[model samples]
Target chain A: SQTIHQWPATLVQPVGSPLSLECTVEGTSNPNLYWYRQAAGRGLQLLFYSVGIGQISSEVPQNLSASRPQDRQFILSSKKLLLSDSGFYLCAWNPSGRKTQYFGPGTRLLVL
Target chain B: AQSVSQHNHHVILSEAASLELGCNYSYGGTVNLFWYVQYPGQHLQLLLKYFSGDPLVKGIKGFEAEFIKSKFSFNLRKPSVQWSDTAEYFCAVSYGSTLGRLYFGRGTQLTVWP
Candidate 1:
């Protein structure tokens, strides 16, 4: 079975601080990875997606970025955090040949 | 560009009441539809999906959704909802030609009272 894992279930960061959130998938290779953010009971907003290592497509301009260094490892980072950056961040993956997306336990970020 | 829409923002129903949530998508080509549930304090889980063949798809916990191509709607239905069914439901769509990136709707929050 495929599973996705994300670290730091909850985070509190100060303004202008650096941030990094990691996501890793098990039982799958060359999967499509995505980053999404949900603001307090709102719909998900796509942040970034990667098809392969070093290849990324960002959906919106923001204070964050994403990277895929390994086949199943994805990272979301920000050089300087903003108060508006606090939200529920989700990481998801879809197997190479399927449309069903598997989601990981999200990271709740609180920027002060 | 493809987009998804869920009609209900919030619904309150008593236990054993019938439940239906509306979802619609706008896409020119073939698309795959999905419904996901997120219980309070939990991650999102797939409830059901529609790839092809049957217009009606059954999901876990006695939930089902019907896909109407002409209407561009995939409405979720349950004969009798339980109090435990209180959760937020999301509708998503992936264009057949896209790279499996799903476009999600605003979502509908369902609250079932005891």
Candidate 2:
């Protein structure tokens, strides 16, 4: 069975602060990873997706960026966060060529 | 670009009430459709998916959805919804060739009252 883990389940940060959210998947290799943000009462917005290591696609350009350091590790980072960046960030992974995506617990970030 | 639409933003029903959540998509090419349920404080879970074969797909928790190709609609249905079914439901669509890029709808929040 595969499991996805995300750190700092909840965080509170001041404006212009750096942001780093980690996501790791165990029991799968070469999986497709995705980063999404869900604002309150709004649909999810895809931020980034990676097909392989060092390959990242931005769905919507904003204050966030994504990186795939290892096959199973994906990180979402921002040099300086904005108030609009506050939302529930989610990390998802699925096997290559598979349509079913498995999501992690998610990180709730509040930029004050 | 593919786009999805979920008709109901919020719905309230009593336990044992039948559920029918409308989902529509706009894409000329072949596409895959999925329904995901997010329980309160939990990760999103796959409720059902439609790739091919049966137009009607049965998912976990007594939920099912029917795909109408001509109508470009995939509507979720449940015979009798329980109070535990209170959750947010999302409809997603993606091109068949690009499995990783999914376009999600605004989502329908279902509130099944006890």
Candidate 3:
């Protein structure tokens, strides 16, 4: 069975501070990874997706960026955080060419 | 662009009551539909999916959904609800045979009262 892990389940960051959220998947290789953010009581907004290592596609332009450093490791980072950057972030993985996705426990970020 | 719509924002039902949540999509070509459930403080889990063959598909926890192509709708159904079933349900769609990406609905928050 495959499992996705995310670090710092909840984070509190000061405005203008740098931020990084890491996601790693075990038991799968060359999986498609995605980053999504959900505002309070709202729908998910796709931030970025990667089909392979060092290949990332941005769905929307924002303060965040994503990187696939390894086949099973994905990282979401920001040089400087904004108040608007606060939200529930989710990381998901799907095997290549598969339609179904498995999600990791989300990271709740709060900027104060 | 493809989009998904979930009609109900929130629904409160009593335990043992029938459950039905409406989901609609706006895509002309072939598409794949899925229903995902997110328990409080948990990640999203696939409940059911409709690709081909039978229009009605059964999923975990006695949940089911029917895909009506002509109506452009895929509605989720559960014969009875339980307190443990309270969670947020999302409906998603992908264009054609390619998984490419998923367009998700706003989601429906279902609360089953004991």
Candidate 4:
């Protein structure tokens, strides 16, 4: 069985601070990874998706960026955080050419 | 560009009542549909999906959804919803051969009173 891990589960950061959220998937290789932000009342907004290592697609340009360093490791980062950047950030992964995606526990970031 | 629309933003129902959440998509091609449930303080889980074949797809926890191709809709239904069934339901659609990129709806929050 495959498992996805994300940390830290909750984060509190001041404005203009750097942000880094990690997501790793075990038991799967060459999986498609995605980063999404869920705001209050609003649905999920896809931020980035990676098909392979060093290949990232930005669904919506914003303050955040995503990277796939290793086959199973994905990272979401930001040089400076904004108040609007605060939300429930979720990471999801699925096998290549598959429609179903498995989501991680998610990171709740609060930018004060 | 593909887009999904879920009619109800929020719904309040008593236990044992029938539940129906409307979902529609705007895409003129072969597509895949999925329904995901997010329990309180938990991650998103797949309730059911429609790839092909059966128009009516049954999911876990006694939940089901019907896919109407002509209507471009996939509506989730539950004959008797339990209090544990209270959660947020999301409808997503993937078009053509893009299997990993899904367009999600605004989502419908279901609240069931015990």
Worst 10 residues of 4 chain A by lDDT: A38-47
Clashing pairs in 1: none
- Name model 4 segments beyond 4 Å from true: none
Docking class of 1: medium
Give the 10-residue window scoring lowest on summed lDDT in candidate 2 chain A: A37-46
- List, residue by residue over A1-112, the lDDT tens digit for candidate 4: 9999999999999999999999999998999999999998888888999999999999898898898989999999999999999999999999998889899999999999
Where does candidate 3 clash, by residue pair?
Answer: none
* TM-score of chain B taken alone, every candidate: 0.97, 0.97, 0.96, 0.97
| lDDT, model 3 | 0.92
Tens-place lDDT digits, model 3, residues A13-37: 9999999999999998999999989
The better candidate by TM-score, 2 or 3, is: 2
DockQ of each: 0.72, 0.73, 0.66, 0.76
Candidate 1's TM-score = 0.96
**TM-score for the A chain of candidate 2:** 0.98
Model 2 chain B poorest 10 in a row by lDDT:
B94-103
Model 3 segments more than 4 A misplaced: B97-99
The full ranking of all candidates by DockQ, starting with the best, is: 4, 2, 1, 3
The deviation in Å at residue B61 for candidate 3 is 0.9
Against the true structure, what is model 1's DockQ?
0.72
Clashes of 4: 0
Residue-level lDDT tens digits of model 3 in B14-95: 9999999999999778888899999998889999988889999999999999999999999999999999999999998887
lDDT accuracy of residue A9 in candidate 2: 99
Per-residue CA lDDT of candidate 2, range A25-89, in tens?
99989999999899987888889999999999998978888999999999999999999999999
